[model samples]
Target chain A: MNIPMSEPITYLEAIRHAQTDCLHTDERVFIYGEDVEDPLGGAFKATKGLSTRYPERVLNAPISEDAIAGMAVGAALDGMRPIIEFQFADFAILAFNQLANHAGAGAWRHGQPCPLVARLPVGGTPGGGPFHSQMVENWLTTPPGLISVAPATVSDAYHMLKQAVRCDDPVMFYEHKALYFHQRASLSNAPEYPLGRAVVRRQGQDISLVSYSAMVWDALSAAEQLARDYQIEAEVIDLRCLKPLDMNTLYDSLEHTGRLLVCTEAWPYAGVSAEVIAQVSSQAFHLLDAPPRRLNAKDVPVPFHPHLWNAYRPNTADIVQAALDLVRF
Target chain B: MQKIPILLPRLGEAVAEATVQTWLCQSGDTVAKDQDLLEVETEKSIIAIPAPAAGVLLDIDKPAGSRCQVNEVLAWLHSNESDVVQPVDSGSPHAAPTPTETSPTHTPTASLASNSGRHGFLSPRLRALMQEQGLTELDLHLLRGSGQHGRIKADDLTQLLEHLQSHYEPHPAGMLRQAVADSMSRSWNRPLATVSSAVKMDALLAHRKTLPERPSASVYALSTLAQALKEDGRIAKLLLGDQLWQAQQIDLALAIDVDNGIYNPVIQSVDAYSLGELAVEVKRLIAQAHERQLPSNGHNTGIATVSNYGSLGITWATPLPPPGHSCLLGLGAVRRQPDWHPATQSWQCIRACEITLTFDHRIADGGTAARLIHRIVHLLEHPDLLS
Candidate 1:
């Protein structure tokens, strides 16, 4: 039911195409969530027209959020791979108990595999109110027996989704709403990467900027600014997965630059940035020349006003300031 | 106006005290902020202490040539506000300023190496002079800068170079040549002693004449030296790490010229072959070396080496044995001179060559090395003994 095209697609379209391929490859694979069926194609259209080809597979679930998760776990336990799409990542809070307590811990507790992939449209949009804008990877990753991944590119979105459905345990796939339509990546014979590995988006020698999600682009822009104005070469790393945490690549880059700057869109304390710095300081202590630095969103609720939101979250300028501080220190 | 105390800054982590090489400003002189106030000489480098602020030099606590400890007040300056106040040690308030007791009074050229910590601010010409004189921070601390804003210029470094040439005996080698110095220093780690003897080469010369293919004297000497090394097991052992490896067969490494660079190529198992075979092998190796086709494999495993410095037209010389070799035989050019025939009590002509053997004292004493040299001389003096 999906139309074919020759040109490359946006990251959102890649996610849609990956789901279509998964639905076609396995008879046990099906998509059941709110607005995922035909005429609606799910929110953000990530599952756009898949219901037309596999009508029985893409079923529209009721508005009960708890039942959606409970049923997905039940279907996976009965030998079916179900892809659940929440209308917004913030709405997942309504079903957190069922997703975390049962779907996440079911396999370990009862020996029943929970082969469920819950795709959440995470992160903020321009002028999106507090109800719609939320990044939940840092929270979802804390639960045991759950694989949390945030894909920063089109190829990653396409491949990581196919891998998530194939995995036996539960997976929380966080797709940034801000990058869904704005970001585009070439998918022509893209190299394969593992789930928990990080990628160096740019190579340098002076300082390292480790970030994930949409903040990866901001870190790269800051690295370019540092090169042009300050003559400081900054290396940028994109941590695609949150749970497994690729400390090897981080240490390798830290050994070369001797300074680390971790950036995230979440709050500063007890976030992913805090964990990264803590691990680096404990393990690669001698490799550091100065204290490791980090930049994160202000510790407050997601702002509703446009200017307040810009001030609350981290940007290229914030990343550049943190990089300068680390390099000069 | 608040007076700020100027303390001697620690140039490096290991530096405890530094000598005030020269004072750029005198007491009562008005100095600008960031201006070079004085130069201090530490063991690692020479650093120029800049003025903490625009101020007048109120008093001099430690004058030029005085050695001062870290955080010891060098001077006091009257400024609008005290921008930097590094407190001095309390126990040393009345401590007398000790003048540098180590070296003699400073000369002009030795003082030109001083520079502020601003590394890349030097002009290309000044940097070139620094590189040419091989001056360091410690050397520059002695100079009072004549350039603008305490910048050491080319002319200052040149004058320092001339002054250093007359005063200091050894010049600092640059980074490129430091490897050679390091290896030679490591070579000196072993206690070495040398012994010399004059050997008559009549039988060796006679043997060379008998062969249609005349072989060089080096091959004959190498063959006899290898035979002697094989007979003495103690001399054939090599110190490899903490353990001594006893060589199964003698490998003679000959220092030869390859593409204008001196290369020592090893002829494997030299003692296992006869003198005639060694002559052929030596000729082949030398020819291959000249063609730049000989490999340097197993060159470091040699127990002994023969250095033919005589080929360069020297009559007598002492050569430091290179590292990794237990002994080195320095052979001088053969000279034909008049000798006293003891039986006839008359003067006669004979060909004699000077040979000096240097060995590591750790493996053998002077007397033991002397016996080895004597054994080699006896073999070369009587060529029939080689068989």
Candidate 2:
């Protein structure tokens, strides 16, 4: 199947295309999640019209997230690839025991590969409130033996999801809801870069702005503003995979620019941004000219009002200010 | 009113006690925040202690001329608010305290203490770069940092190196030049002083003419200084920490100018050799130094060094001693001067030159240095004693 290179595709279309390709290539692959069947499709319309194409594989599950994740783990162990989708990332917390204890440690303890992918819609929209908008990638990534990935670009969104389906281990795929219809990119025949490798979205020298998911866009915009206003060139790195963190890419960028600033939309306490800083400070201590810092969302529940949510989440302006302070430092 | 103590901040790493120089504001005067309350003199410089907060100068605990240690309260200020009297610029030694509030919009202050290069708060990357390039903190004193509070950042060092590379062509110093530089830099750590006096060289010139083979003026001065050191070895004592180590032999080194740099070749026991033997030895060493063939371990154990800078047409010089040595004796160019003979009521031309002795002041005082230089001048004037 060839995706048209002439027209741009949204991040949501990239995920659907990836799932369609997986179902077409492999007969044993199936997707099981709440409201994923025909007509209604998934919660974000990611699986729209998929049930008509592959009716046997595209099936809906009961509304229990725990039962849905547990069934996927059992099916993966029984020699079938299964993909589970949570309507929102916040609901994935209900399946924590099944994902972390059963599927996460399946291969290590039982010596059998658990080829399952849990697609979680993460990050905020204008009125996502507390339940539908939380970024649960940090909690999913903390458990060992699980590969967690948050793709920011349309190409990575298409390529990395296909890679995750093929991977022998279980993978948690975090798709940013806010970027579904907002970001668009034309498909290319570029070879898929291996997972666990970070790409430099922009080349710079003054500081390294490391981020992933929706925060990568904010970091890129902040880099542009820094270059235009302060003459500070900020290198932006997109960490497509979070579990097997590509520290080498971060270290390489830090070698040129001794300052580092990590941005994430999650809360600060023990979040992905904090983990990045802790690892960089320990392993790449000598590469740092200034102390490595992180910019995270305010330590509060996702606000309901649009203006409150705007201030609660880390945005382009927050990233710009953090980068400037790091550059000056 | 809340009484806030104005403590003396740490001036520098080694400074302990400081003398209160003058009080800028009296006890009853009301001072604003950051206003100079008093000036204190440390060994490094005079620093003014500022009011930590806007208040009245309630009392002067340590008045002018009273010495105080670090963290000691020099005075007390009566502030209006008790809860908000935060110590501003508290850790920085020289910066005056200014009232600053922590606002939500302001950038959070970095947790690392801000320090200048001299304070030695070096980052790991900066330290690694310095180690790779064979540089110490003292060697990079001139590099100004753009980091917080004027701390030297790693980029500043790399930028300095890059600026040097683009602006100038670098030629790696030869081993001999590097050795000399290392020795001179180590010797410069001590407090060194030079004393000079003029010696009439007419007798020495006349005496050398009587001998079968004439010795160079440097060899004569080397021999004279060796004899004076042998008479009082205290003048050549090497100060190691608080103890002085006296030499067992009166060995001296002769500074010979080579192709790119100077070599100081040691002549063991100069008092043991006669004038003719010493002249031949000095000639051999000079030839070997010019050819860069001096034995590696043969030059560094001398107790003192004698430099004949007069050979370069220099009239007088205060040359530094080599590392591990305590003193250096330098001989200047000889000049023919008109002298009046009062006993015969006549004027005559005489040959005279200046002799300078540079000594490490940690081992000897000015009187000791002056006496040693006077003895050298005496021996040079009476050349028969040198033989």
Candidate 3:
């Protein structure tokens, strides 16, 4: 629990490590979902070496989410681990009927959790328009059945996926395709992310910017700029989970900063942003300097316009402005 | 149609009340006691009473079937034409009074368990009772459970143990009575005592008519009341009781009156359960009770207790502290019409259920009981707490 965060590594290496380590630790775990074979581990390059190392365990399945998730549910019922992968994050939505409705809530309601994991390649910077580029966390996080985790860094992608693979509950492993090559964190510096705990990527004193997935890097970068430009030490919290949120850490940051700005890829209304603002306001209203703020996409679905879309999600510049406005106010 | 005054039968060995089996005398009919007027079953025996003063029976105060302690009248008797006689406590061919439950005074501890403190809580007799009913030491909090402080006797846990035994279908009075002996022994160790009162259930039943359930419907008062208990403090922990060993979020029990004894079946996990869930469980428990397929227990590390006695206008009833539990609740029948509280001078019209909170003198005082009762009352009034 007290591991350090210093070294930098790529999201790809983290996920591979998570796969191999989990497969090594638990014999019950085996790979499935798509082209998880000897030569190509997956289109996202996450399962690259998994097939070679775990040839017997790595399996390729027909492109049917129902069969895949249902088969995994059966495996878990028999007390086995079934890690599934979808070629594209958006394509994984086809399984939502099973994942969210049936698989997610079946256990807690009936006293036996569905122990499965679906690793989806999520996020847009790879120039994937509505078809391929989509942050699935926005849609999959709040549902009842599975716990959704979208790791932005390599070490997280590695260890958290391992934990999820071993967890008694099913998990939605959403690794950002944008951060796969991210080397900001070294393997040595990787701190284990427990199931439900918000990590403070950058410690600040004046304002708090809460985000998850790839936005952690941007928020941290903005925190650095905000500190030097206006001395507003923005505490950047990387929310690893979209559900069963670690509200305590987030609340503490808001209490200290007295101002809140939530940054995410989803739309503001009825999204994660709404949930955060409501929880913080209800529990820590006395500490607010102004009402909590969130920078998110418009109501329209993620568009194909690269230039116009650049304005849709928050970036380093937008984050800096958010901090600046709070500082000036 | 008939008003019968339920009375406690005279048991040979310090036994008190008797659960009514069936009415031997019909609502409108001539009757003779020696002719099996009605069955009065207790921890002692299932005996019948002779007609007090043979005449055309006018009214039956205590119906044939109820849980009434000894010495209380079973029915009213009147001579034919001119003689007008009041129901006499004595000089009537009725069952005798059980000093244990009906006595105006407390009995000596020696009369309950022995002076031996050694297997105080785990004597062969006590173990037999517990094993028979499926209870454990963890079942009792503190208080060796002996009537005397630091002693564990069968009598301390007798009433509660008997209460648990009554959960079984067609529960044997001998089993209930023996369990009662053990539970009372344990209950007495702690200064915990029970206070029971009856309330009119009409208002609650009427309100129930207002909120219709979606499908598999259930209705319970204790679930709402537990929310009231929570207003006192953040819940410490939730324990489960039953075959599945599901955690009981709400610590409430429905007290059912059977022929040989009284049983209190616990409604599990009211704390985490929604009102709908509570209703469902209450319905299940009641069905089990009616079919005589009831379990032999109400196990939960409960903070409070509730006994529903409003069914037959037994508005006020005494509650026996369940073993290891701190408080017991006795709720009375809802009146067909509301009562005017002369002190408040308010015509409180909406439906109301009577509740009595019996608390451990060792753990909670009357003041604390009042606070708890206030919270429970608040929750019952605002059943939205279930939401």
Candidate 4:
């Protein structure tokens, strides 16, 4: 399904377009989740127009994440492509056993193709309590054989989602709620980027700023500030996919910048940032001028109050300061 | 007569001691205010201490070649008594001498090492410079720092780097050069094929005359090539590791010679830029490249690469595109040559240049590459097509 190139689309609209494209292209591809079929269109309405287009393919599953995930796995095993949507990424915990044990491990254990895509509405929205907001790429990626991708731009949202459905392995797709209506891109300018490939959002020489999901915008902002204020050009890389992490892009960037600063909204210890830094330090030690650094959310649980939440997460200032320190190191 | 103590000043951060390299004035020597009293050496640099007030050198408390701690009394003076120039006892009870002070005692001091650990640490920028200069910690330990508590600041490292750079041959593979090498290596692994076409620049030269700022032929070629790519999708394919990528935005990469190495920084969204805008952006990128401070990271992701060998006064040359790119364009020198003009029915003087297109054979066939070059030459000969 080709979109009219003249119009621009928001990140949410891109998700809808991606689903529509998948449903139209593949007869086996179907969307299953609670309240996803009609007027409700699920939480956040990413599937708002998707159900209207294909009533048979866009489904409304039981309200239980475990049962929904188990059903998706069974359907996928039966040679049907299933896309399971979780209202909020935080609810993925309810189906962790099914997702990690079966969907992720089935391909490894029985040589079966688990062509399933789990759409997770992730990241904190204003006033979104702890139970409603979470970045769960790390958790889903912990299991073997599962691909976790967090798209930063509308173009990536459209491109990567389509690729996720075509993937032979199960994919955990996290869409940032904050970027739902915030980011916009021209449909005409959508590049054909493949899944598991990282893109350099902004280029700089002095430092490499690596991030994924919503935090990519923050990294780009920090890089701009660094260039304007300190004359430090920072390179920003968006790790679109997490599980099959693009180490090549990160290494190539580190080898050029000679310094690396990994930024994430997730907590610092043993998280995505830590894992990236560890690999870069080990693989590109000779290329590094200083120890790699990371900017992450505060270790405390995410608070509900707006002010507390603002302080709890890593913002532009935090990333800029971390990059400045890393470059000066 | 009142005597004033001349103490060793705190040179820098964490510096507890320095060796007296020379005594500018000796006992009984009358020195004016703010005059050189002694010269001392630290781990980073050599510093010369001056007299705080005009006075007669009463005694040399810690003589030359002695290790004196910061604030240790190095000498004594009769305050404001330049006329009474009499030598006093050099060995006063207030004098504290460390073992390394005399006889060039080569004993390694653990204090300096411990001080370096906690207080006088090197910044990352300084450390990077040190690594660039091929300087080790031992070399750092040999120079005296001027920073607080004897810490090595970025400026100090810069000076050391300059000194080392002047004394030895500069490293051939600097950071930027290494980046170029890596990019070239990636490009070299690809199966490259080249196609060339000759274009008459009679219209292009006339078009440049009408513009407010007369842009170079390379700039004109860049604009025309970007237009051609935007119009045709068959030429805008990037192949990497079994994945074929289609270009959403047309970006152009220009290779600039920076005296030392070639720097190819991409000008993004070039298809949307007009001739004037392209000229300014190209000029800015060229300036940045020459300054050796171009912001080059993953920004090298251009749809096609362009090498203006003509600008460097070269004829035809084949240039390879960096990996993940499908095509590259080379512009040779435009020169006045005699050619048969069918419209004039006679030999006429016309400007002509050779345009070479090196493309990845894996993505596009020879026919596609030939068509792309043909489009570019057509756009150049008929400049109205671009406007």
- Candidate ranking under TM-score, highest first, comes to 2, 4, 1, 3
Q: Which ten residues in a row have the lowest lDDT in candidate 2 chain A?
A: A320-329
Residue B28 local lDDT, model 3: 61
Supply the global lDDT for candidate 1: 0.77
TM-score of each: 0.50, 0.80, 0.45, 0.53
Rank ordering of all candidates by lDDT, starting from the highest: 2, 4, 1, 3
Q: Candidate 3 on A144-258: residue-level lDDT in tens?
A: 7678887777777877888888788889988877787754566774568787778988888778899988888888899898777555688999888878788889878865666
Question: What is the per-residue lDDT of model 4 for residues A1-329, given as tens digits with 9 covering 90 to 100?
Answer: 77755588899988988888899999999999999988988887878877888988899988899999999999999999999999998999999998999999998878898999999998887688788877887788788888899999998999899999999899999999999999988878678788989899998877899999999999999989888877778999999988788999988887667778888887777778888888876776666655677878888777899999999898998887667544533
Error of 2 at B172 (Å): 3.5
- Which scores greater on TM-score, model 2 or model 4? 2
Put down candidate 1 lDDT per residue, B1-387, tens digits, no spaces: 656668776678678799999999999999988899999998877899998778899788899999998656788887775333332111111121112211212222122222235321243444545666564444565654433224443445566778878998984555424533444556787888888899898778998887766768788778778877877746656676898767777776787744424556777888777777778888888888778777656435466778787888887776656677778887889999888999999998999999888887777777778788989899889887776
Clashes of 4: 15
Chain B alone, TM-score of each model?
0.55, 0.77, 0.46, 0.55
Once fitted onto the true fold, the runs of candidate 3 whose alpha carbons sit more than 4 angstroms away are A1-8, B1-387
- For each of the candidates, the C-alpha root-mean-square deviation to the true structure, in angstroms, is 16.1, 7.5, 32.3, 29.6
> What is the overall TM-score of model 4 with all chains considered together?
0.53
Off by over 4 Å in 1: A1-6, B1-50, B53-387
What DockQ does model 4 achieve? 0.02
Interface RMSD of each: 17.6, 6.7, 34.3, 14.6
